[model samples]
Structures are given as structure tokens and as C-alpha cells.
Target: MSATVFAGALFAGPVLAGPLRANANDVPLADIPALVLPALGETLIMVGIVMAVVVVVGVPLGAIIHNLARDGLFPNPSLHSALSWIVSVGRSLPFLILMVAIIPFTRLLTGTNIGIAAAVVPMSVAGIAFFTRIVENSLRSVPPSLVKVAKSSGGSSFQIIRTAQLGEAVPSLIGGLTINTIAMIEYSAIAGTIGAGGIGYVAITYGYQRFDNQVMLATIIILVALVAAVQVIGDALVRLTTPHSSTASDRRFARKVARLDIESANAASPV
Candidate 1:
């Protein structure tokens, strides 16, 4: 009975869904190229704007938080605690909830609370808090020894952070950014619910709503391709920026090679 019901549900999904089958034939092959291409461009623009806003705001905010010394400049435990709490609250909110909750702000910015412009508000807000944490974590991971060395060389706190800490933290920060960008792509789908047009919107409007399985399948393929492309680019960037092997590993390999050479010399000399 359960198997029969499951099969029925799967078979009935397209029939029961209205928009899923709407005038798909009305969408010309030529029009598809025009529609999808422009949508892709809009999505990229939205992502770029959000990424820039988040980075600009998040990086400085994180730097300030990470640099909070026990007795240094701008030392305010209460402020730090408050900002951290705010970030926590933002992260805890589901993306859809955040989108709906910020509708008024979206209206204020975009005048209609719909489309790529409206999507930017919630997406960028969520991104700022999310990326701030990543930035903070990466900055914190910078070696204390490097900072100490900089100080011993008569470097100021600002100089140490600018020259040593940030330089060392770049690879990790880039990695975090890469991951965050990918996540934002996935999150952008929720923006479609509020009438933001992306491939996800295309999928729903012309596929799920219209019962066009081909369109849904095509959208999924495009999304998967986008994700794979991001991963490949991120990996290439990490390899280009980061050290591949540890100094200790290199030292160990050198020692093993030297020992083998010495053994070979002894064997030839005596045996």
C-alpha cells in the first residue's frame, strides 16, 4: 500500500502542479537563450554586489574584533560582546525568514521588494555576518610568533597586523571567501520565493510551476555546473597562494635522503 502510494505521488506530481506545465511550448528555443543568458548575468551581478559589500564591511569589522587586545586600543568588552551577539543572532536566522523579515528594508532600497536589487539586501546582510566570522577565524589563526617577531623588530601593533598577520592569513581568508561565495549561490534560490529572478526562479516559473520536467532538469544541470566551476577555481587559487608542504616534512625528507646516501657510501667503501 505504501509503495503504491509513493508511486502514485511521483506520477501525479506533474499533473497536480499547474505552473509546472504552463505554456512551455510558448517558450521558443531562441527565447530560451535570451531569457537564461540575461538571468545568469543578473545573478552574477547580484552575487558580485553582495560579495563586495560583505567584504568591505566584514573585513574591517573582523580586523577590529580580532585585534582587540587585553590592554590595547579600542578595548571594549561590552561592545565586542554585543557585536558578537548580533552576529550570532543573524547567523541563527534561516535565510527565508531573514528574507521575509527584511521586506520593508528591501522596499525602501528597491521600491518594490522584488527582483535582483531586492534580493541583494537580505543576501548581503546575511553574507556580512557570515563572512565576518570567517574573516575573524582566519585572522585569529595567524601565528602569534610572527606578531611577536614583528614587535621585537620595533614594529607597532598596527604594523605587525598589517605586515605579518594579514599577509599570513590571506590564504585561509581566501579559502573562506571561496566557500562563502559557493554558499551564497545555493542561498540565492530562496530569493526566488520573493520574486528575485535567477535560474532557480526560472526553474520554478517555467519548470515546477509549468510541469516542464525538461526545464527543471536543465536548471539543475546548470546549477551543478556553476558549483563545479567555483570549486575548481577555488582549488587553483589555494594552490597558487598557499605553501603545499610543511617545513618539517621537507626537513624529514632531506634527512632520509642523506641517511640513504651515507649508507650507500659505506657499503661501497667496506663491502
Candidate 2:
């Protein structure tokens, strides 16, 4: 009898509990694209805005944090500690909890807390914290000898950082940017669950609540493809930026290669 009932439950999933098939509101598979595409665009816009903010703010902030350390160009223990603690606090909370926790702040800033604009606040906060660490780590991977050489050459602080530090770390930074962008895509979905509007909203409203298997499957496929495409593009960029071998000469050659690639790319591309 137990076996029979389990079989019945399995059957019920598609034949009974999935009453979406019986409902007048059931969406066809062909129409799933129509609904998901707009949501995808919204997700893209959300991630794009957050990434712009993350890059503009995260790079400088990461540089400041990195430079505050003992070995950094400028050491400030107090300021470093404060900033590190703040980033830690931001990283500690899960995105869902963070979203709820920052509702008042979001509303205060955006004057509302239920749209894409409202969602950008927490997303930017989380993205900035994550990308800042990525930038710091990438810069750390640069050889200290490079900085010394720059200083000996009479390079100014900003010049030393821009050339000896960030320039050498470009590949790692690109990889990190890819990871951060993917993360924001996920956050956009989470934001959608709370009515922030995106692919996540479609999944929640049509896929789960309505038990629409078609919409559920479509969203899953689209998300998988989107992520895969991003990963592929990111991996290619990383390869294009990375040195052929781990040697100073090889690194210089890689920079030349990257420069050529950059020249061919559209303007405003990352260095």
C-alpha cells in the first residue's frame, strides 16, 4: 500500500497537484520566451548598473584598503581596520537577510522598496564588498619587487599603483569581475522573489506558485544558458589577458597581446 501511494503521489505531481494544466491561466511553452525575455533584460540592467557602481567604487576602495596595510605604499592601521570591519559586516549577511535588513535604508534612498531601483542598493552593497576583496587579492598577487622598481624609477604613488600594481593584475581582476557579475545575476533573481522584478519574479509567480512546469523549465534553461555564456566569455577574456608562462618577460609579452586586443575592442574597455 505504501508503494502504491508513493506512485500515486508521483503521478499526482503532473496530473493533479499541477492544476495549472486545468487553469485558464496556464501559459504555453511557446509563450514562456515572451515572458522570460523582458525579465532577462531587467536582470541584465540590474546587474549592469550594480557592476558600474562596483567598478567605480570598488577599485579605488580596494586600492585604499590595500594601501593601508603595513607593506602598502601608505599605512594607516586605524582606517584599514575600520574599513575591513565594515566590509566584513557587509559580507556576513546572506543576500535575503540583507535585503530585508536594508529595507528602510533602501526606501529612504530610493523613496520606494519594491522595484529594480530599490533592489540596486543591497545588490551594490554586496557586490562592492565582494569585488573590493577580489581587487585587493589581485593586487596582492603583484610582486613587491615590481613596486620597489617603480619607486626606484621615481614613479609617483598614483603612477606606481596604476602601472606596477593594477596593470600587472589585470587578468586576475577580469576573472574576478566575471565572478562578481555572475553573483549579481543571482542576486537579481533573489531580489525578484521579493517583487523586485526580473527572471526571478517570473519563476516565482508562474513557475512555483502556479505550478507551471513549462515556465519553470524555461526559466531554468534560460538561466543555465545565460550563466554558461557568461562563463565562456569570461574564461576567454581571462585567457586573453593571462601570460603564456610565469616569467617577467612572458608577462610583458602578455601585456602587449592584451594591448592589441584592447585596441581592437570597443572603446571604454577595461585595461
Candidate 3:
């Protein structure tokens, strides 16, 4: 099984490369840079806009949903269920259908539903729904015991969320954002068929249609580099924000309380 899996992975790249490189000599080398940069820029624009909208919209929505337990503000099961259904329906729509279905509205807003701007509308909307679930999951991972501790100490819902819950989940939330950003890149490629100008568009226009294999190969290399850069930066940020392994403030506090209990027990023991 292991060997089979390895063999499959090994052969996949060459199989894909063969067709991509079949007519490599026909593409103009001079046009490669021009195509590459514009495509890269369009991808960045789409992803950036989507990321911004997701953060602005998803985080607040998640915070609200996370606060929907019996002890939460406005703890109505009906409302919670309704909202969950809506979010679920949003998530259930296939991406391609959602893109096409939203074209009329996208056209109205962007003035041309067949370009990069139009693509952004659907991409951003999809991202908001998708990342909201991620944010909600991250927030929910904050332990109930921790929330109780904060409440026992007179913390309000907002205060507890602001000080403890969000702080505890920052690392995970950052990680999710990194993953979502990578996903946005993949979606941008898919959006190319609808006239979204990215490396994907370049691939379809030159590689598939014109049979310019060189353009296709170069575009693939550029995408690989872009994804690599995002991953490296994300990893560095994750490492930087995470607490040092040597830090034991939580353990020290527990120990201090335990020592006090021991001293009290010794004093109360019969002579």
C-alpha cells in the first residue's frame, strides 16, 4: 500500500507535465513575464479582498454563534437553529453553481460579471460563510472550565471573550486564516474560467487553447512559488506568537495554591 501510494505520487507529476509541455516551443518567451505578473496581481487582489471581508464579517458572526449556549446572551434555540441552517445552506452550495448563480448580482455591482471584479463578489461571499465556521470552531475550543473561571471572577460575556477566550484561541485562529488564504488562491484559479485574470486564466488561454505549453509550465512554477511563500510566512508568524514551551505560569499558580493547602493541613493536624 505504501509503495503504491508512493508510486502514484511519483508518476502524477510526470503525467501532468507531459501534456503541458507537448507544444512548449510555440509560446513567445518575451510574453511570459507580462502574463505572469498581471495574473499574480489579479490573484492577490481577489484573495486580499476576500480575506478582508472574511475577517470583518466572519469573526463577529462566529463570536455571536459561540455565545449561543444555554448560558449565552439571547440563548434561544430557535434563533440558533435558524442561523445555523442559514450558514449550513450557504456552505452547502457548490462553488461553481454559486458563482454562476450570483452572476446577475455580481454584474450589477461590478458592472461586468465576467471579470476579476465580478469574481471577487462570489469569492468574498463564499469566504465569509466558509471562514465563519472555522472561526466559530476555534472560539468554541475555549474550554468551558476556563469560561466558568472567568465568570466566577465577575467577568461579563464580552470581557471573558475579549480577555480569555480570544486570547487563548489566537494561535488557532491565525492558523485557520493561513489555511483559508491558501484556499482563496485555489479558488482564484477556478474562477479563471469565468474571465478572472490570474495564473489560471493564463493557463487556459495560452496552455490549453493556444497550445503554448511553455506558458502553462511557467505559470505552474509561479503558482508553486506563490504558495510556498505564503506557507513560509504563515509558519514564521505562528511560531512567533505561540508561548514559549519553558513558560509555566499556569503550573506555578497551581503549585502555589497546592502548597498553601498543604501548610493549612499541617497546622490543623492533631498534635
Could you give candidate 1's per-residue lDDT for residues 63-112 as a string of tens digits? 77776644333467877878888888889899999999989988888898
TM-score of each: 0.78, 0.83, 0.77
For residue 178, model 2's alpha carbon misses the true position, in angstroms, by 1.0
Worst lDDT run of 10 residues, candidate 3, spans 1-10
lDDT of 3 by residue, 1-271 (tens): 2332344456658546444343435546777788788888888988898899889988878777777756654477777777777788778888778888889889888899777888888888778778888888898787868877888999887888876677788877888888888878888888888889888888888777787756777878888898889888887676666775333665686799999999999899956
Q: At residue 135, give the lDDT of candidate 2.
A: 94
**Model 2 agreement with the true structure over 157-185: per-residue lDDT tens digits:** 89999999999998889999999999998
Candidate 1 residue runs with Cα over 4 Å from true position: 1-31, 69-74, 244-271
Instruction: Report residue 194 deviation for candidate 2 (angstroms).
Output: 2.0
In candidate 3 the C-alpha lDDT for residue 18 amounts to 47
Between 2 and 3, whose TM-score is larger?
Answer: 2
Q: After the best TM-score superposition of candidate 3, give how far the Cα of residue 159 lies from its true spot, in angstroms.
A: 2.8
223: Cα error in model 2, Å: 0.9
lDDT of each: 0.77, 0.86, 0.78
TM-score of 2: 0.83
